[model samples]
Target: MDRWTWPAWVGVFGGLLVFAGLFLPAVVWQSRRYGRLSARRLLGTAALAVYGVALIAYTLLPLPSGDLAQWCAEHGVGGVQLHPLQFIADIRRDTAGLGLRSTLTSVAVLQVVFNVLLFLPWGIFARGFAGWGVLRSTVTAALASLLIEVTQFTGIFGLIGCSYRLGDVDDLLTNTLGGLLGALVAPLVLRWMPRPAELVQDRGRARPVTALRRWLGMLVDVVAVSVLGAGLGIGWTLVGYALGDRTASAPEVLTGLLPVALVLWLPLLIGSGASLGQRAMWLEPRWSTGEGLARGNLPRRIIRGLCGAGGWGVLTLIHGAGPALAAFVLITALAVPFTRGRRGPSCALTGAELVDARAVSPAVPRAAASTDR
Candidate 1:
């Protein structure tokens, strides 16, 4: 129970860390590929992360430590059980002259069951979540089982210098069988999961801009600016150390200037005039009444930038302005839901509308038709 419980807890902790790290990237990918996020798919992704960590924890955890020779002699499990279906004979011998319940409860029988159940999720995930065929899932499961067996036999590729667990051929066979069974039942188990093809079918079509989408995009921009600032600070400190200037510190101006460039200058000069976060969320700014973001539209672009994430970035650099920045962010977030097209503070202020980047402009079709004539 301790062994199982410990690994389960470890899996939960590690899984959450994995989920947190992948959350933003996964959201970005889904928004781009599916034109909208699916809560069900996101939940599935989270489950996958937990399962992945649990797999590692159960297989290779509680590593051998301290007084290697003594531990190996007294407690270590070594050598290979190469005979196929050996567990059947072992179970039968142990259960001789015993009742049905006793046989079922015996260690030999239970071990085989545990091994089988361990690989079951692999087939389910491969077939249902990953959309793999039955044969492929089964074969892959077999390969994974084989790898685990080899690793155990070689004592984690000679890391511990001796095997700490038996490499059993019976375990491999049972594990593969479990995976095959799982694959066969995957459809029934995962009936609610959306097909990848269906999700991407209308990916190029426009989606309505929502407050949640706006908030997520803003979050991405904030995170990007923070990451960029941290990275630049680190680089500056490293360069200073390399130059033997122990007292050298990052310049206040460069940190502020670079973030402004990232959120403001670069987007204005580049395609679609969307911040990095907005682009990731498949959103862009468009003039509400007339021309798109063109070279001659410098003033509008500047106004939009100053009112959006770029402005936030600049404000963050000012000393003793934390409260003001917080207020600005809070007000903008609150304003999003009330604004037309769910526009953020920037769009509302500049008379620009937020739209899905994939949405085709109304004038594009007419211009193309004219060219054909």
Candidate 2:
């Protein structure tokens, strides 16, 4: 056996450490929050299986034989070295070949299609963890790709004397695009093959939370709402100011508009969070109608967060006529229900309901389940 280098050891150890840290947290959080969705369990298991298969293939597959490496060396390009820029240049040059143009186009298309397919599972698993949304799911997918790339680059270089893996910037770009593509497709997949809900069930009946737990939950919700809303509001204000009035400093406008924008948009942000965040936290937010947060779903949640309060923040800072008027209308409408013991506009728009986080039983493994639903 060949001797492993320092880099190899670092790569191997580092990969393990990183994977362990990330995997453990994701599993714990998902298990606790979503409970058991048989569909999610199956999808997760399938993803792991595919990943393992890919890893095995990557290891056992023959390297571009000695001839190819020798050819590369003769051509003045160092073999088994990190040359990201050079690799991209080579790709561009090769794409211009006369006879190979058609073949290259086909290959490029196939590569993109496969890449998109590869991350579909990641998107699905991420949605189960964070709820279905393009941005959140895409972010999760990108992070996952980064971890994989770093592990591969570091581990391979350490174990072997040379960097056997070509760490291309293209991979990061492609992987993220793929992940987003997958996330975009997830909603459709979910609609057809819904996630199973038996994997994380609790054995006992739902127990009412003690005072401490209830208080803690409320605190968590409040902090999450405030931080998320404030951050989004600030971001929108900066963008609005930057695009509309280049003369005024974004900071100046943002600071001046912060309080009013926050006050007007607070209900929407809090109410949306009350619905979506509760779902992510593995609790169902039900309204007086006995319906859980009206599948206000991901799209609605994002609009409420980004457009409602966040937009109001930007408008407030800019003193924009349209947004301010819209904000006033929304605020007034929300306030109307307050007279009758109902919640604010967000609750009305999304049909906000009650929130309950009771544990059920873990789902039965997919393989063990009967075909009949």
Candidate 3:
């Protein structure tokens, strides 16, 4: 790969993610601070993203080590550079015989630059997002490098059977130095960031009813439920296999019902009247106005879930996922336009109503009020 190519790829990918962040408000109706991301959060999120990208690139790029890797494994050997300044020594040797141009073209020179530059974001992120000071940032940088080197040194913890890359002490030094430099310069580059302490907090987003918000929340729920179901089903099957039970099965209902129950129960139990989906959309199911949800309306929530995703899943399980899935999606989607306020056809099934759960002042209890006086 060209020296500049990896950074360019990171730039393009990171730019796309930033662009996607703009649409998050349309999909998610609430967050810690909803709507727009403050400058601090934006910078913090961006720094996090860039750091993650560099980490992946540095550790895992030049994939498919192929036959050479297998040969090395058979021979029981791999590359290592335990001595510090090995990079400088190699560069100096090349330049002495072949001139300075030889040093510029050398892979050793690029390795030093990329290794050092790769970790700069770690220092910036430690201070900027995590609120670590200089000393903490340096320690964090050292720890991170140690982990990376160990991973390389062990060949992805022996799964690959041999190390494909050289684990070098100089890389650690350069990476730590890069992080320290980034930490030192972070205040200047991030001067415009908003301090969360001084900034206004979100009370959540509320509107009479919004179809898009409702859809977005439901979408998040669908993904959550699917992931939950798959995890449960897969884990059960694996457990059964490990125990040597030939008849062990991973049931579809096990996947669907458990996740559905937890999603409905936990948040309501937490005194948030919202399900995971409703919370994402900043709307909650309310049996009555101004009520705390210590115990929820399980019947209503389950009814809504069935109407949204649980129903579709049951159909898929019973009818076998092809035409039934397609038909359900079409009918539900077309029904939205005819339904008043797009509140969903199922909302009427159990007399359940979706309420905007944002911005109402918390009601003080009588005992607490009296104690305050």
Best by lDDT: 1
TM-score of each: 0.84, 0.35, 0.68
Clashing pairs in 1: none
**Candidate 1 TM-score, true structure as reference:** 0.84
> What is the lDDT for 166 in model 1?
84
* Best of the candidates, TM-score: 1
Task: Residues 296-358, candidate 2: write the lDDT tens digits.
Answer: 455555454443334434554554477666665466344633522233344346544222334
lDDT of each: 0.80, 0.45, 0.63
Off by over 4 Å in 3: 1-54, 60-70, 73-80, 97-107, 129-131, 160-163, 187-212, 245-248, 264-273, 287-353, 361-373
Weakest ten-residue segment in model 3 by summed lDDT: 364-373
Candidates sorted by lDDT, descending order?
1, 3, 2
Model 1 deviation from the true structure expressed as Cα RMSD, one decimal place:
4.6
How many residue pairs collide in each prediction? 0, 24, 0
Residue 292 alpha-carbon offset, candidate 3, angstroms: 14
- Residue-level lDDT tens digits of model 3 in 82-199: 8988888888875676767777778778778877787787887777655679889988898889888877777677766777566878888998998998788877766666544444
Global local distance difference test of model 1: 0.80
lDDT of 1 by residue, 215-330 (tens): 99988888777777778888899999999988888887666678667765688777677888888888777663343332226788778888988788778878999999999899
Report residue 170 deviation for candidate 1 (angstroms): 2.7
